[model samples]
Target: MLLLALLMGGLQEAGARPNPQALSARIEVREHTARAILFELRVRNDSGHRLTLALGGRPAYNVLVKRPDGTLIWEWQRGQIVQQILEYRSLDPGEELHFEATWKLVDARGRRVPAGEYLVHGVLNLEPPETLVTDSLRVRVAPAKRRRSAK
Candidate 1:
């Protein structure tokens, strides 16, 4: 089990230094079962002022799973159809947002993936057409167990 934490500076102006008092993000990936995995993303507003995120629609954040060689396996928003309407989310000081999703150890096509080590990370959707990416975490998936047949 590996947990990755990332500190992101607040929205900065062109040629301006990053704001230390900005939102921070953390991600964690763990095995929920031999055939499933759990992904979590936590975002906190640590600054004194309220933080606002300009999102496109549902799912303000996304989780990505890929192999060590950078082969894309699964994504949290693969088949999700969200409204194109723009939405703004605000977080007060000391406020946090938590998001979780479960993957059945399957690929985007709903096929079972082989048991092995996979790299995973989280992406935060923001305005200005920029995204915040967290560090990658390595998680292991166990092999599936075969069921016995009754004679």
Candidate 2:
């Protein structure tokens, strides 16, 4: 998993360097559960040009997630997993735009995730969605560990 991340880091760096209006993303997850988890994704306009971003038809921002193998984890575009899209304003050159949202993690049957190791990713739905999905962003989901006392 670390190796994959390393390779992606290099690929993503190259992707973000070329586009003047491109969007770069970094995600930090506070909690992980089948129901939902708190996520703070920082988006920046690394290019030399300033850009405007929107989420759910507003001057806001949202987040999407997928598996490392290119499986669909969750998406705000269809309002499938998450309840609503987090909002944000414009992003200036080299400026940071913090996008916070609660991700609704579910199993194959739409059931909340149990405890386990899963690789969840964040999708940046830029005006012209990013082409480098694999290289864009990746996050790991560490299912909350529960301790049991001996009887």
Candidate 3:
């Protein structure tokens, strides 16, 4: 009975949280401008032996921007045709990989976001059941400026 309970709880908990330490990875989101934001995802091989990472599909990672209320506003993979081919890459001990994407303060439908606070994060699409994600970042978008009319 105890083992059954542990298995049920542990499996659900493991998949619900970001496991950056599992791959010695770090993610950062920063405001490049009031109308743009940047995402940086870094992964390092801290193990002694070469670490092999299986890429689940094309564009192995993604960036997400959402409202403070958890409403998704932008997704890096939206409308992208990601190939469903598996690929592998090896990282030597102490080596690292970096991935980046920028959001232009727009929603999935390509409209400017209103001036407000938003949350952003990065997701690494590894093998099945082993996805990695970065903690959500809080960002603010400034109001758009009006265009000047020519005299």
- Which scores better on lDDT, 1 or 3? 1
TM-score of each: 0.79, 0.50, 0.77
Question: After superposing candidate 3, which stretches have Cα over 4 Å from the reference?
Answer: 1-20
lDDT of 3 by residue, 1-151 (tens): 0000000112224234332333565667643776677878777765555656665688888888999999998999898999987666777767877888999989999999999898887777766655567667777889988889999
Kindly list the per-residue Cα lDDT of model 1 for residues 100-144, writing each as its tens digit. 878788999999998899988887765535566767878888888
Which of the two, 1 or 3, has more TM-score? 1
lDDT of the structure predicted as candidate 2: 0.49
lDDT of 2 at 50: 55
Residue runs of model 1 more than 4 Å from their true location after superposition: 1-21
lDDT of 2 by residue, 55-118 (tens): 3334234555656566665654454353344333455668875656776666445655554445
For lDDT, the strongest prediction is: 1
Superior by TM-score: candidate 2 or candidate 3: 3
Angstrom error of the Cα, residue 108, model 3: value is 1.3
Better of 1 and 2 by lDDT: 1
